[model samples]
Target: MLAIRLLAEPERLDTLALPVRPARGEESRPEPVSVTTALPAGVVEEVAALVPATRLTGAPGETYAHLRPGRTPGRLLLVGTGDGDEAAWRRAGAALARAARDETYITFALPDDASPAAVRGLVEGLLLASYRFRLTDAGPTPSLTDVDLVVADPATHADAVEAARTTGRMTALARDLTNMPSSVKNPQWFAEQVRAAAADLPDLTLRVREPADLAAEGFGGILAVGAGSVNGPRLVELDWHPAGATTHVVLVGKGITFDTGGISIKPVPAMKLMRKDMAGAAAVVGATLGAAALRLPVRVTTLAPLAENMVSGSAFRPGDVVRHYGGVTSETTNSDAEGRLVLADALAYAVRELKPDLLVDLATLTGANAVALGKRHGALYSENDGLAADVLAAVDAAGEAAWRMPLPADYVEYLGSDLADLHSSPDRGAGSVTAALYLREFTGDLRDRWLHIDMSAPSWADGDDAELTGGATGWGVRSLLRWLATLR
Candidate 1:
């Protein structure tokens, strides 16, 4: 684990990193902004002479590194923070982390006018952007260990800094859960991991329901999906109820530990990445842990339906009609569309038993969402306009992206079925929209206050971008945590 320390005042340092922003009013060319630096006048002049040739205009995610010559070698990095926004700061922090990868300890100079939120964003970006997860038998490898950020007033930004550290830790945990191999991460394994992570947090309580418990509870959707797997299925519930909390929010995540598409099966190329099918569950767990760590004044009940959609003799067929909790049935037209089936059971349970004031569900429910919105944004579907706006606001503040998709009433017809009350997948177009609609059926009368986030694409990052590594991105933790802070 990397240690992120906040410095009250500028400390004497041989290695100094300074933020370089774009030219402001009445300026045409880029220049290194004044910061807390210990560089001598001669060295500063040397850097001035080389700035033009380097073409470092302070673009976000850009860095220029130069070694100062002397009896002792010193390092200098000109990091970019475009427009000084939260997103820009995130990019700048990532670039700085990469630039300083070789050093054991380095100091970053924060602009005097930087706000607490910007400082928090910078810490999160550096922590997550430098993230690398690998399964190895070798003992812990040494790498960049300590980051000391010099801010104008550490006292003013103390809370933000600590919050950023917590956010980064939880997000990394999520990425680790999603990046684990399916061979090791069966439904039972997922439940045990959750248990271990929540052991220290006494305010957070976890309950794991095994296959028999699920069967007695009438979770046909979950049981049918996991019937083919030897590992069976689990419903992991975590509750965080703090003192003086009014609003109750229930979060449901689709935990398809490995999606081979059940009986239908997936193509060879697609099944390779099925390990990330449980990203939604990972994200919810991250958010719940974050809430508990931060001690936010809100009641939260998180439900994760864990299962492995594999192929076997007992696998549910495509034509099967499965009954969920509360007796709602889905005509399983496509075995590949198993996320919604499991989510239906969890959502129905949340509404019937939890009686939450707000319902939010996250799932990698459809590839069509990825096809439509690409990997940069999450597809958000909700009938509650207020909830949509709040989530979008949090997305902006947290530097994540999500586009609001509609829940067209006319599309409800797409979920209609002859054998059951609803069908899992649409016959033709609007796969993502219909998937959201199908999940909405399980929400019962709480449809108006529900939010269905189809995070199919954004859950996995293709490459190392600003504030994210190459594998599981842990995309929802930051945004969801920020949104939860606004409740009540």
Candidate 2:
């Protein structure tokens, strides 16, 4: 994590990043944008004097970083804040981070009129872009150690700055867990990590269900999926209950630590990417912790069904019919679709026991969602129009990408199973739609308030872009945090 400091007035600033806007009209060579700020009277004029030499166009993610030794400001970085919007600030922050990757320390003066949201977004981009998860014993680490955000009124924007820092730290936790090697990231390891993290959070309780407890409680779906692996399954429950909290939100995440596809094995190429099958689990855990840290006024309980779908003689087969926690039987159609099986048991349990006012589940449940919404956005599914609208609003406010997918009643026909109450995976054309419909079955009478997020593609980024790093993107945490904030 990068050291983030909100400075009211620093005595020294070796390197400075100045925000620039685009020129009025197009030209072969556009001049540097006019500097504007409430900075010291002489400082603005100093930067303005060098604008002609900078020769920088204010494009998002564009930067001119150079260090002039013995100069008052040792290094000057001109960052483009396109349109002076939240997104542009994020891009500018990211560009600055990459450009100054080798620098030890840097100071950036916030725009004179930058809102709290823009400040938060800028820090989020810089922190997330600087994130690096490496396992090797010997390698170069990111040289940029600390960052200073020079603000005019630090007291006014202090809360927003902390919120951004908290979000960045929590998102890093998700990324680290999701990027873990499959060989060691089994059910037990997942449970232990969740427990350790919860210990640091006050008033947040954690309960772990071992294999025996799971068996006694009739978690047939979770057990069936884990039967083949040497590591047995586990269920983690993280609870954040504030005094007099009226609203209850239950979150379920599919924690398939590693997916080998069992009897219905995927191609070698697809199987190689299975380490992040548990991205959903990491996401929910991250969100719950964020809620607890922020001391949000809503009660939150998250259930993570941890399992490893491996190939062995004891593995569940395509025709196997397994009863879930709440007696809903599912006939497994594709062992590769094991996420929904464990999720079914978790969701059923949440509805039967927790009885939350609003229920949401996050999972990398299907590839079809990527085909529909692309990698940038998660596919959201909900039966109730109002709930869907609320979630989409939060996603927009949080600066996360997501699209609302339809839950057409007609798609329920694809999940009919002669041997069981539902089909785990329908081979129908609309795999993502059918998958959402299958999850709706476990929500019981509270189905209208349930939100299903298929974040399969968005959870892992192909490369660094915007606020996302190269590997695990920690997709759902920000959106979940924003939605939780909206409650009450």
Tens-place lDDT per residue, model 1, 1-488, is 57888886655466778777776666576666666435455655666665677887878778988887672227788888888887888888887887887888787778768888778878888899888888885765436788888876788889998888888999999999999999899999999999999997878988999999999999999999999989899999999999999999999999999999888889999999999999999999999999999999999889999999989999999989999999988898789999999999999999899999999998988898889999978999888889999999998888888999978889888887899988788776889998888888888879889998899899999898878889999988898899998996
Alpha-carbon TM-score of each model against the true structure: 0.96, 0.95
Instruction: Compare the candidates by TM-score and give the number of the best one.
Output: 1
How high a TM-score does candidate 2 get?
A: 0.95
**What's the CA error at residue 436 for candidate 2, in Å?**
0.5
Which lDDT tens digits does candidate 2 get at residues 56-132?
Answer: 66777788776668766777887877776777777787788888798898888776577888888888889888989
Which residue window of length 10 is worst by lDDT in model 2? 28-37
C-alpha lDDT of candidate 2 relative to the true structure = 0.87
- For model 1, the superposed segments whose C-alpha errors exceed 4 Å read 10-12, 36-44, 71-73, 137-142
